[model samples]
Target: MKLAYFPGCSLHSSGRDYDKSIRMVLGKLGVDLVEIPDWNCCGATSAHVTDENLAVLLPARNLAIAEGMGLDILAPCSACHQRLVIAEEELKKEKFQKALKETTGKEFAGKIRTLGILEVLMGKVGPEAIEKEIKTPLKGFKVASYYGCLIARIPRVKTFDDRENPTSMDRLVDLTGAEAVDWPFKADCCGASFGITQKPFFHKLSGRLLDGAGDFGAQAIVTVCPFCQLNLEMAGYKEAKETPSRTPLPVMSITQWLALAMGFTAKQAGLSSLLVEPGRLRETVSR
Candidate 1:
């Protein structure tokens, strides 16, 4: 199967590990990814706040390009997936359609669909297919599947899993032979960009998530959003430093974990770039 891949801004920059793992794992699953050419930022977090039309148009252009390619889009980042899905919904309205045409000189045929990585993994490539490719099952590892806010919180748009209690990522983690701990913060906010704008509040929110995961006996926190991973790692790092007895929970992108189980090296999955290393998880994988 082939799809148009949109790495968005974060995946190309802060979320490189996610991009690497998604490409590698999907390639291993016999799925081909054709990147959207000349793709721009999806206007996540900032664009919609400043200018709604600009936010819609930003992803609409990418959607138009993907529509021309006649392939569904696989946007790995949660924010990107949400933004693209929002644009698709907006395009259904005549005003947004006219705006898109006036701005980009292109027509949106609404011929394709935008999917998050979870949707692609669970819907397109089932866990059974992935199970067949696993070379090193993470049999005893325990992780918390963090979904953050954007992936499934959009009320109007249809999401693959339950909005409040998502199990898609948990199921994927379980397929790796790792146990996805039943934790309360799965769909909670990860304090997002607040880590930069409002440090204290970000710490408080992210700290609660880390504390919750740790209390539930989670060895690591797995996520699908770059901001979530970054924020959680940042919070975990500071928390560990503040309290010597506390160990920083390794925050990993779900694709990175899948890549490890599929026999890819840590370097190949960009694990070295993470602020909090998965030392214990690495040992378990080696064993």
Candidate 2:
């Protein structure tokens, strides 16, 4: 399978782990990911809150590029996936489509579809195929698969699993021989960028997620979004303020976990790059 990969901004920087492991895992699965040239930020919340036209046009530029590549856009970042998909839907409107073409001097056929990495993994690469690729099953491991928001909220937008209680990530976890605990807050919002502008609010929202994962007896929290991973990692510090102190539960990308099961080294899978380190969990998996 060939896909036009859009790493977005965060995936290239703070979310490098998601990028690396996804590339490695996809390569192992015989999937070729062609990076989109000259891709820019999807504008995320900023462009939407600022200028209406900019929001549509910003992601439309990348969509046009992906359309040219003649492949679906595989965006790992939840924000990028949501924005790109939303922009594709918006561009269907004659006004937005005409405006976009006038501004960029390019006609977007709305042909390029934006898909989250989870969708590609669970949908394109079936769980059976993934199970076959696993060299080291995550035996005795237990985790809460956290989907956060963006990926599963809107029913109109194409999503991998249920909007409320997504099990795509959970099933993927099961494929590696890990127990995906039936934990709450699977679709809960982590306050997204609110973690930056409002620390107290961010902590309150993220703290609940962290505390819930521990309360459910999970050893770690598996995530697909970088913002969710970052917020949950920050919550490791703030969680003590609310609940009884416990060992910091590692917040990691789903791809990172899969990479480990697929026999990739810790460094190769970008496990070392996580803010809330998974060293203890890695040691446990090794033994």
Candidate 3:
């Protein structure tokens, strides 16, 4: 279970809960995550389309740092995973590799392998291992597993599964003895930066996810990325200016749910870090 873990900038800042929950749950599973020393930003939302060289170099520097450790990079954030994976793919090409080498002073050999923590949990740890550790199964829970654009999107560059209705996360949720609900807006975008910029857009989008979850009688909606969590959870604050009444649905990172299923303390899973008040819905999930 030893892997090079990259938490990206957001995890340390606005998304510390994602990092906390991940480390806590993975620790309970006996997984060793060694952080990449001196790791830089993955340039997730901004750099790619705006600054060409930065898009490659930003992730290239992180990839090179991971390469130095001689371990595969395990990124919990889907955006970071996508960016790093894209960097690995693009840097392997001749023109991009030349630019990366010029900026980083090290020729990236593409030895750096990137993985979403979800991938490791589902495929590496497998459903059986997760099931073995479940102390309180979510027997009655009908959950909507939200896989945002980055992890499964971006074509063959960062993609490893069917982008349309990828079932790994949903299956993992189901293996915890819960019913993976066929909620609408499963493959729909949750309006990432539009959460701040074009917030009105994702308000409707986030509400759609919430409406779908509520309609299916889901206990909670689970996601792997902080951006998705923010977009869905923080919608009302911004969207209220336009159209209000956004449902305050609880969106837990998969790590939070896993730790809860394993019967770990809420403190251990950083469940207290959630913005949405899930306490009211305890009976819905814990029954």
Candidate 4:
């Protein structure tokens, strides 16, 4: 099962662990990820808001390259997945395709399908297949699976799970034999939008998510999006400092948890990149 892989900008920089864990997990699953050639940024928030055509053109160019490969695209970043999916959907229309071709110098047929790594894991490779690869089942590990707001909000673009109450991450957590705690705010925004400009609102929104997970007695918050993990951890830090009662929960990537349980060490899974350290969780996996 070879697919065109798009790691996006964040995966290579701030989310390097996501790339490492994703590659490790897919390699073990017998799925080959061929990265799209000369892939450019999907222009997630800024491009779309500033220049609409440029936004579409950015992701469309990447999709056009994948179309040549004759394989579906597997995007790891949530924003990249959303941008690519949205670009594909828009390109299907004649008017958008015409403008896109003028800008990108290539006519796009929207032949390639875009899927987040989560969709590929849950649909293309079954959980049972992942279960067979686990060296240590994450028993007694209570995790809050945070999907953020991008992955499944648009059912038309990403039809993998319910937008409001997503359980794909939960199901993946369950495969590790970990307890996926039932908690509200699973799909809530992590306030990535205002993380820089509006610090107070950013902390408030992101802090609430961390607080909610902790309130539910979640030991760790498992997330698929790097922005969410980064923001949540940032907010968690501020939240912990102000409120002594709140113990900062370790925010981990989906693949980080999977890679660790599947016999990969913390260093191998890029656990050191995480802001909030999983001290006990690391100790448990080490033992």
Candidate 5:
């Protein structure tokens, strides 16, 4: 149960809650994550667009470091996972590998197996195992899960499931006895860095997703990516302020929601900090 873990920049910064909860929950599930040494930022949004070389090299460097340790990598953030995966794929290209090795003095076989944290958990433990661990049932909750772009939408890459219609979240929700309703916007974008550069624009996109969730009778939107959580809650709240809604759907990381179902404290699960608390869902779990 030991694997190389890449938290990426967001996990350490705005997504600290994600990192904390991930560790706690994994420990609860009996998994060990060994952080990669001196791992640099994954280049995120700007890397691939501005300079392809840097985008590939940055994650490649981390993969190289992981390979050195003889451990497969498990990435938590979708962006980081995508970048690392993309870098690994790029290095596999005969031309790319030769050029990269000569320039960077690094050896890459694309040998490292990169997995999204969700993939590892859902596969290694299986839905049946997770079901047994649920201390409280989320019987009354209706959560619409969000997967965002990078994790499952990259064309031709190893998307864990269908990009447009994902079942990973739905499966996890079902294990906790919560209903998982079909959400068309499950694979939609939340406007990455645009959260700052284009706040208004991103908020509108986020609002559309939340509005979609509410339309589907969702009590909350569960997610694995932090960027998705940030936009889904903070931006959705702002939009709800401008336009009144019956229930401002709360945005929750899958980790947080799972912790809640397992009866973890509000502080431990980072619930109260959310602008729109999953109060209704909280009541459901307490019972």
Candidate 6:
């Protein structure tokens, strides 16, 4: 299966592990990723907050490029996915379509669909297919599947999973032979860009998530959003330092964990780049 892959800015930078694991695991599943040529930023938090028109147009340009390829887009970053999805919806309207044509000189037919990583996994690549690729099941590892906020909570947009309580990530975690601990914060917001603008508030929000995961006995927190993973890991690290008795839960992209289960080495999956080392994951895989 060939699809247009949009990794966004974070995937190439801070979320290199996510990008590596996604490419490796999808390759194993025979899914070819054709990156959109000259793709621009989706204008996530910044553009959306400052200029609504620019926000829609930014992703609209990328969508127009993908439409030319005649393929659906698989955006690994939840922020990118949300932006692309929102742009597609807006382009369907005559007003935005005209604006896109006038500003960017591009005509978007809105032919392709934008999907999140979780949707691509659960909807396109079934659990049965993934199970067949697992060489080493994470039998004893327990993880809290963190959906963050964007993946399933876009208003007026049809999401793949339940907005209030998503189970796609949990189900995928189960296929990896890891138990997905039931937790309330799976779909909660991780304060997104607030981690930069409002440090203390971000810490308080993310800290609650970390504490909740530990409270539910999760050894690690699994997520699909790069921002969410970074925020959670940063929060986990800070919390650990503040309270030496508390163990920091390693935050991993869902793809990272899947790649490990599919027999890829830690280095190949980019686990070593994580701020908090996944020592428990290594131990569990070794057993």
Candidate lDDT (C-alpha), each: 0.90, 0.86, 0.79, 0.87, 0.82, 0.90
Per-residue lDDT for 137-221 in model 5, tens only? Answer: 7777788988898888776686787777778878888887789988788888887788889988887788788889889988889
**TM-score of each candidate structure, all chains considered together:** 0.97, 0.95, 0.91, 0.96, 0.93, 0.97
Q: What lDDT tens digits, residue by residue, belong to model 6 across residues 91-125?
A: 88899999999988988996789988888888998
Error of 6 at 225 (Å): 0.2
Show the colliding residue pairs in model 2: none
Instruction: Return the lDDT, model 2, position 125.
Output: 84
**Candidate 1 residue lDDT tens string, 190-256:** 8988899998899889989999999999998999999899899998888778887878889989999
Q: After aligning candidate 6 to the native by TM-score, how far in Å is the CA of 19 from where it should be?
A: 0.5
CA deviation > 4 Å runs, candidate 5: 98-104, 240-247, 283-287
Better of 5 and 6 by lDDT: 6
Candidates 1 and 4: which is better by TM-score? 1
The residue pairs found clashing in candidate 3 are: none
- lDDT per residue for candidate 4 within 228-259, as digits (tens), equals 88888888766667887766999989999999
Give the better candidate number (1 or 2) by lDDT.
1
Angstrom error at residue 41, model 4:
0.5
Backbone clash total for model 3 is 0
Q: How far is 201's C-alpha from truth in model 5 (Å)?
A: 3.0
